[model samples]
Target: MDKVLEGLKYAAAGAGGLFAYLFGAWDALIIALVIFVVADYITGIAKAATQGKLSSAVGFKGLLKKVMIFVLVMVGTVVDKAIPAANHAIRSAVIMFYIANEGLSILENAGELGLPLPKTLKSALEKMKDEKPEDVPAEEQE
Candidate 1:
C-alpha cells in the first residue's frame, strides 16, 4: 500500500507538470477560461434539454469543440516558445479569445433557457466576441 501511494503521488505530479507545460501557467485567465468552458457546456446541455433537442451526437461534438479550444491554446504556447519576443502573447490571446467566445455562448444558452441577461453584459460580450485577436494592434496587446 505504501509503494502504491508513493507511485500515485508521482503520477499525479507528472500529469500536473505536463498540463502546465502544455497550457502555460495556471493563471487567472486560464482559470476563467476553464470556468467559462465548463459553465458553457453545462448551460448548453440545459438549453438543449429544455428545447427537447438534446442528442448524444451533438453533445459529443460540443465536447470535441471544447477540447479543440485547449488544443489551440497548446498550439499558441508552441508559437510563443518559437517567438521569444512574443512573451506568451500568442497563448494569452488565444485564451482571451476563447474566454470571450465561451462567455457569449453561455449567455446565449441562458437566453435560450429563458433567463434574462443584462443588456450591457450581452453587448460587451458580443463586442469581445467580434474582435479577433489578430486584428488588435501589437501595442494594444502589450
Candidate 2:
C-alpha cells in the first residue's frame, strides 16, 4: 500500500508538470478557455439531445475539433519558446481566438434550446471572436 501510494503521487506530479508545460501558465486566459471549451461541449450535447439530432459520428467529430484546439495551443507555445523575444504572443492569441469561438458556440447552443441571452453579453462575445492581443494596450496585458 505504501509503494502504491507513492507511485500515485509521482504519477500525479508528472501529470501536473506535463499539463503546465503543454498549456503554458494557468492564467485567467487559459482557465477561461478551458471552461468555455467544456461548457460549449456540454451545451452542444444538450442542444442535440433537445432537437433529437444527436449522432455518435457528430459527437466524435466535435471531440476531434476540441482536441485540435489544444494541439494548436501546444504548437503556439512551442513557437513562442523557439523565438526568445516572443513573450507568449502566439499562445495568448491562439487561446483568445479559441475562447471566443467556444463561447460563441455555447451561446448558439443555448439559443437553440430556447434560452434568452443578454444583449450585452451577446455583443461582447461577438466582438471577442475578432479580438487580437495587440489590439489591447500594454497597460492591460495582465
Candidate 3:
C-alpha cells in the first residue's frame, strides 16, 4: 500500500509539472477556460442525449478535440518562448479564443434546452470570433 501511494504521488507530481510547463502559471483566465471547457463538454453530452444522438464515437471525438485544444495551447506557449520578446501572448490569445468559443457552445446547449440567452452575450462572442491568436497584432503579442 505504501508503494502504491508513493507511486500515485509521483504520478501526480509529474502531471502537475507537465501542466505548468505547458500552460504556464494557472491564472484567472486559465481557471475560467478550464471551467468553460468542462461545462461545455457536460452540456454537449446532455444535449446529445436529449436529442437521441448520443454515440460513443462522437463522445470520443469530442474528448480528442478537447485534448487537442490543450495541445494547441502548448504549441502557442512554445511559439511565445521562441519569440523572446513576447511574454505568453500567444498562449493567452489562444486560451482566450477557446474560452469564448466554449462559452458560446455552452450557451447554445442551454438554448437547446429551452433556456433564454442574452443577445449581448451572443453578439460579444460573435465579435470575438475573429479575434483569434492568428488575428492578434504583434504589439499585442507582448
Candidate 4:
C-alpha cells in the first residue's frame, strides 16, 4: 500500500508538471482562476441541491465546461509562445477573464442559495458583467 501511494504521488506530480508547462507557469493568476472555478462549481452544486434540481448529466456538463476552461488557457499559452512579442499576455488575459467570469457565477449561485451579498459588491460585479472588453479604458487595458 505504501508503494502504491508513492507511485500515485509521483504520477500526480508528473501530471502537474506537464500541466504547468502547458499552461505557461502555475502563477497567482492561474491559482486565482482555479479557485474561482472550483468555488463556482461547488456553489453551483449547492444551489442545485437546495432547489432539488440536481442531475448527474448537468453536473457532468459543468465538469466538462470547467475542464474546457483550462484547455482554453492552454491554447492561450500556445498562442503566447507562438507570438514572441506576446510575453504570456494572451495566457494571462485568458486566465483573468475566466477568473472574473467564474467569480460572477459564484456570486450568482450565492444569491440563488439565499445568501445576502453586500449591495456595493453586488452592484460592482453587475457592472463588470455588463462591461465589454472594448468598454474598458485603453490605459487600463494594458
Clashing pairs in 3: none
Clash pairs, model 1 backbone: none
TM-score of each: 0.86, 0.85, 0.80, 0.77
True-structure lDDT of candidate 1: 0.87
Per-residue lDDT value at 127 in model 2? 83
> Each model's RMSD to truth, in Å?
5.6, 6.8, 5.9, 6.1
**lDDT values, one for every candidate:** 0.87, 0.84, 0.84, 0.83
TM-score of 2: 0.85
Clashes of each: 0, 0, 0, 0
lDDT of 1 by residue, 49-106 (tens): 9989999999998899899899999999989989999999999988888888888888
Q: Whole-model lDDT, candidate 4?
A: 0.83
Q: Kindly list the per-residue Cα lDDT of model 3 for residues 37-141, writing each as its tens digit.
A: 899899999999999999999999888878888888889888998997889888888888888888889888989988999999988876765554578573532
Cα error of candidate 3 at position 79, Å: 0.8
Candidates 1 and 2 compared: the better one by TM-score is 1
lDDT of 2 at 14: 93
Off by over 4 Å in 3: 1-14, 131-142
Per-residue alpha-carbon lDDT of candidate 2 for residues 1-142, written as tens digits (9 for 90 to 100): 9999999999999998998888887789989988988999899899999989999999998888889889989999989989868899989989988887788788878988999988888788778667546776734221
**Candidate 1 or 2, higher lDDT?**
1
Q: Model 4, 1-142: lDDT tens per residue?
A: 9999999999999999998779999789888888988998899899999999999999998999899889989999999989989999989878877776777788778988888877787666556445447775744321
- Model 4 spans > 4 angstroms off: 1-16, 119-142
